[model samples]
Target: MSLLALTAFAAAATASVPVHSVALDHRGGTYKVDYRAAVETRARTIGMSAGTRPSTQRCIMTATVSVDRIIADGGHELHARVPGEKTFTRNLPGDCRGRAEQLTALVEDRQPAIGAHLAAAAASDRQHALAAIDAAHNLASN
Candidate 1:
């Protein structure tokens, strides 16, 4: 192949793919207290059987929110991710299944609360953006 043709082919093959960058605009806000109640309710609803001998378990719930800025449209996009972990012990195999079910129920019941919290946080972020815009406008007008 000709040198020029080979060089052209190599360049085309090596051309970098367009990459997009994402930024998260997070805001701090308080979540509704009812979420905790829902979680407790779920736990009770999935309660263990009689003489099941109460067992101690540890669980952690982690939630994350991400917001995307659309430069062209001048709008923000919000997203949420909820993750949880659990550790427990049970005597019978059936009890183990019940415990698993309880955990799942707990997570399911709290989903609404998690979503509410994310929405609240996103609203807070929008408030921040508005405040910034107002500040800039005020400065520009002065």
Candidate 2:
């Protein structure tokens, strides 16, 4: 490959954002949570609901959680991909940074309770909720 092409490829590879970690609490009956994943600048593949199509040019994250038997027979896993573009030419805008900070805070506030529940629940029941919560929390914090 040409030197210029190699440099461009390296830059693009390095440009991809990385996911961060955050904490969570799940004492409340609410299992649904939201958080930001690593940022990305290029089109990417993301898993979606059975009937939905994967997205492109977006931020993607995964989630695994156990629902109440009443709500879902077993456990479920999910991947959430938000559609958007990221520009690194300058410092992130105040609004965007604020939103990111808020998400981090939410994860920090919620992880523990969820983790505790996962540790205490039956293996089968625990798998669904714990996996989902862990995936969601990991993505959000990332």
Q: What CA RMSD would you report for each candidate? A: 19.1, 17.9
Per-residue lDDT tens digits for candidate 2, residues 6-108, read 3443344333222322233354434433222332222222333343654332222112222122122125435443333223222221222113333333333
Worst 10 residues of 1 by lDDT: 33-42
Clashes per candidate (backbone, < 3 Å)? 0, 19
CA lDDT of every candidate: 0.33, 0.34
Candidate 1 has which clashing residue pairs, if any? none
The deviation in Å at residue 41 for candidate 2 is: 4.2
- On lDDT, the candidate that comes out on top is 2
Q: Which candidate is the best by TM-score?
A: 1
Cα-based lDDT at residue 38, candidate 1:
14
Quote each prediction's TM-score: 0.26, 0.22
Residue-by-residue lDDT tens digits, candidate 1, 1-142? 2455334433332232121232333224222111111121111123334566764433322212222322111332222222332222222223221344444443444455545554454445554444444454477689
Clashes of 1: 0
Using alpha carbons, what is the TM-score of model 2?
A: 0.22
Q: What is candidate 1's CA lDDT for residue 105?
A: 41
